[model samples]
Target: MSDKSIRVAVNGYGVIGKRVADAVTRQDDMQLAGIADTSVDWRLRVANQRGYRVFAATPKAHTSMSKAGIVLSGNLDDLLDEADIVVDCTPKHVATGNVALFRKRGLRFIVQGGEPHALTEHSFVAESNFDSAVGRYETRIVSCNTTSIVRTLGALKRAGLLKKARGTLLRRATDPWESHQSGIMNTLVPEQSIPSHQGPDAQSVDPDFDVVTMAVKVPETLAHLHYWNVELSRAADREEVLAAFHSSTRIAMVRLDDGLTGINSVKELMADLKRPNDNLYEVALWEDLVTIQNNELFYAYMVDNQAIVIPETIDAIRALTGLSTDSQKSIAKTNAALGIGSALY
Candidate 1:
């Protein structure tokens, strides 16, 4: 760990951006340089009220934000000038346009999985590939579902048990806050493709594994649940499969027998625990439901789409700045800072 703190600025203040900013404040080794966003709404105002120095994402946004009576530190360029690294949480395809400026300033950066892996040339999952990102200019933190896949399956692979995996994801229809504006109700929309983007994206972080994923967008907006049927290298006992998942600190084993019957139930538990935003950072696996038949193991888990990648983004910051040389050490610090290690059930 570094004796000094690294500066981090968030370029977007929406769902993922706001969470990333709050997670940064919890870290002893990181300082929030500032936050930049295009909207002149309550979200940006909340960032300012929370004591984060806020910046307008564009000159037009600057003028509009200033006129809207929201206090501003400066524009986007000014915010980047004060930071060692910036985590781009802007919407998909939108952040790509901002890359030229980040590169011009010689700043190390991290972008959400909304952006392509080719954009950064390196992808990160704290436990799986922290060392690869060390002292690197930038990396992409894969999306929520992808992050969960990597962490869970990556755990099994490390234990020398994984052979091949297939999963189906039940994704929330939309973010809770945005449900009013858009979302399908009383219906289920499947991705219409086999081996969804998530499967390919996970392999970007570690290319050796064989994994395939399919997804459906559900009517609710609480979180995502994935059913996985994995073929182990050998016929392992149920305890052995649990042991593999236990190897990952970020995997929280929950029990269906405990009455945490669905994704909403697990999310409600997080709220009961008083987690900020009621965030469930770890992959909440159904411990009692993990089943084994011959050489195949089956289980299901919930992925908190909004909060899962926050810790990974934090770890990427430490790696890019060389703040810590060890991957486990970095993950431990992030987990501690974010209250991430405890099991909900």
Candidate 2:
């Protein structure tokens, strides 16, 4: 434990785990203490990496990584005992069991993007509920859709100008691999299955702020998109709410093409955009006209649903540990560059 570093261990080295680990290693205040995975091949690559200590009961991936000139040197228990913070990017059900184990060892945890239920007494979104998560040993980032939408909503609500909010989320099935087992590679599958937490995750952030969600999936595997409808509690113009979303540093509200017809269906929306390779990197936004029919109000924003959530995961980790986002942004940006499309696409 160097005076300048906060040792961190990333558990479950799968897709989200790898992303989280890469982000942690690049932070000046944090050190990647190593990782634990059931995969023999993965452990070797991690073990072989230079400047990092990797350990495993099996030597396959560790040997491969070492042969490729990597640095690894610690076992699983060593990681649990040594790190200042343990980030569990494991699957939701597995996470619930493991989180308690980490706590028994007196370690603080960042419960991955899944399993808000594991949060028990932990906080929800970083920007919205981090004030509650800080100083606590455990907290969960809401599901990716919740992370993206709630961050935007929290920013908008905090501006003190909104009345009420309503939205629908079109999410990719990729989000469930580490947690929900039934949702991968399916199309047009709609349900309010996010949060894994019973209620929409947004109200967990702000109780008075009402939000309803309709979620759907598709064959395309790029990213999730959200159709947002917001009504300010107090009487206010739509532009004022749009301005609030636009001015937000955390959320990016995009421009809709004039010739673009409203996409009432998820399949058409994905096809219309051609499902760009780097969909998650860009915040997808589109405009829709509000219709006042039957004495009811309607409004919506089309958004690249996954864009803001990952950043918020980083934000939550930073908040829990008091790390500066400015210092960490460069590395995250670099990872984004190298990562480009396939990883997130």
Candidate 3:
């Protein structure tokens, strides 16, 4: 590895891509090499306005982007040439197709969790699998919901408190800005399957974890809420479980005084905090809602689908680059760099 900062490129400037690019710019040990996208939409313009070198996802998109009055720094080839690592946040299945391109360049890359686990060397959640991901060329940061589930369960597992876990995920229909996509308003669609893919996805991060997850898409766009029922191996008091979560740096405890009763309130809190892109990277745990009875724990937490994984992507960059092997150290550095800490009360 070079003594200089790692050059990181972000492909696909959608919701997650744009946030990753901004995060890369904030990191002390990483640089935003450039960003690539297929369209010349407002997102591309926003990237350009932020002074990032914008590259077309492909050579063919260059002509169309130029016609749309958007200038390009170079094509995808140029981005691969300059970046030490590429964070592919392209739509599902698109990053898989680009893997061969990165491999041909001898470049390390990170993919979002929307892609299947088979596409990457291993699935990653900085807090759960940071050590496993170190020095790995291909890493997939697990989905927002998966990250939330793993973090909560991982914490319980570490404390020898978890026996079996199950949850129902209330997912947002679409990203806040993606109004044109389906399921924007007046809907509560169940995922039509028992134990949605989230359970298996979480298992990919930690195969030993036994969890069953069901999901439903709601009309809100603020975030995804998870209601978890954790059966502990031994009897545990609410205070004991709360203390375990409190010990985790990635879990941000939200007290009632924080004025965060639900996802919208959490968004408002982020806005009030002046977070970049109103990002909420930590798993927002409702302090008041945490309950336990006869070794069974129940609680509700919110995951900002568009933001929670951003820090994990940064941690993956460090892991792939041999920057850090300690999950706590990497998480601390990433969190501090991104201004991710406890929520304002």
Candidate 4:
């Protein structure tokens, strides 16, 4: 790796953007160039307190932000000029327009999964496609749900034990901060479809991988739970499947005895451990949930939606800057730097 640090910028300073900026700051080969956001809120204020160069995402927001006592470094163009690569963490559907801007400036960028599937050259999961992302101008990190799905399936596939997989995703209705948003309380809204878009989103990352998924939005902000039933080419016992997950670096096995018997318990564990943002980066799987019958494996795992993609975003920086070509090495570095896999739960 070169001695020079990669200058990285974040376009949005919302939920994911703040985490990405923090993750970038922790990396040895990357620096947080600045963050751009349209609004002047607690998120931007926190970015300022953390000593990040804050930029205005839109021209009109500048005057308002200045009025709100928040100092602005420059506009979006200036931020693009200063950054080696930008991670677009804008909310879902907001990044479509920014793609053309990045292309116009000839700047390499990483976008979140909320963007369209075709927005980038490829859908990136560091463990599955890190090498493919190197030297590419645009890389899209799959959504939190998609990340959980792909990691689970990818591990089984790598073991040559996966045939077909079907899952039900119990999604959180809103983020912890989005209490004012509709559907944040007292609801379990199902996505009235046989197979939700998340399965197809996962397939976009690996066309050969087969999975069918259904989703229901629950009124909790902790995590998204996935219940999967996978068919293997050959018969495998529960121990064998659990062993496969244990061998994988990105997957974390949770035992009942560990005091993480439920999703809320996992969150409490993060709080007790004093994890930043109470983040659990690894895919958390229940030890007792793994079962096998007639070559079919059934298991349940939880994905910390807000934290799952932070490491992937960090890996994207490595890929875009040609800093690291090996996914294992990149993952190890990120996990160690951010305390990802060290949590008790």
lDDT of 3: 0.88
Per-candidate RMSD, Å? 1.3, 6.6, 1.6, 1.6
**lDDT sort, best first:** 1, 3, 4, 2
Tens digits of per-residue lDDT for model 2, 1-345: 347677788777765666666656655556787776555454336534534555542356456545655455655677777787777776656788776677788877777556754255554665566566555666776666666666566656777755556666565656433334545553377674643231356665657666667677664444565655566556556566556655544443333444444333433444455543223432434434543333234545444433434455555665566554342353244334333221111
> What is the overall TM-score of model 3 with all chains considered together?
0.97
Highest TM-score: which candidate?
Answer: 1
Candidate 4 residue-wise lDDT, 1-345, digit = tens: 235989998998888998998888888888888999988778778778878999988889888898887888999999999889999999898888899999998999988998887878599998788888988899899999999888889989888899999999999888878857755566678999979989999998888788999999888877899999998979887777877787667788887787778899988877887889898888989877788889889999889999999999998889878888888899899988988763354
Q: lDDT at 344 for candidate 1?
A: 56
Question: Which digits, one per residue and each the tens of the lDDT, describe model 1 over residues 1-345?
Answer: 344889999999999999999999999999999999989789977887899999999999999999998899999989999999999999998888888889999989999999998998898999899988999998999999999999999999998999999999999988999999999988999998887899999999999879999999999999999999999998779888888898898999998788899988999999998899999999999998899988989999999999999999999999999988899899999999998884555
lDDT of each: 0.92, 0.56, 0.88, 0.87
lDDT of 4: 0.87
Kindly give the stretch of ten consecutive residues in candidate 2 with the minimal lDDT sum: 336-345
What TM-score number comes out for model 4? Answer: 0.96
* Model 2 ranges with Cα > 4 A deviation: 41-52, 57-72, 175-187, 192-199, 258-283, 287-308, 322-345
lDDT of 3 by residue, 1-345 (tens): 235889999999998999999988888888899999989788888778889999998878999998997879999999889999999999988999999999998899999998999888599988788998889888998999999889899999988898899999998888877757656566689998989999999999999998999999988778899999988999888888988898777799986665667788888888988999888889999989998887789999999999999998999999999888788888888988998775444
Clashing pairs in 3: none
Best by lDDT: 1
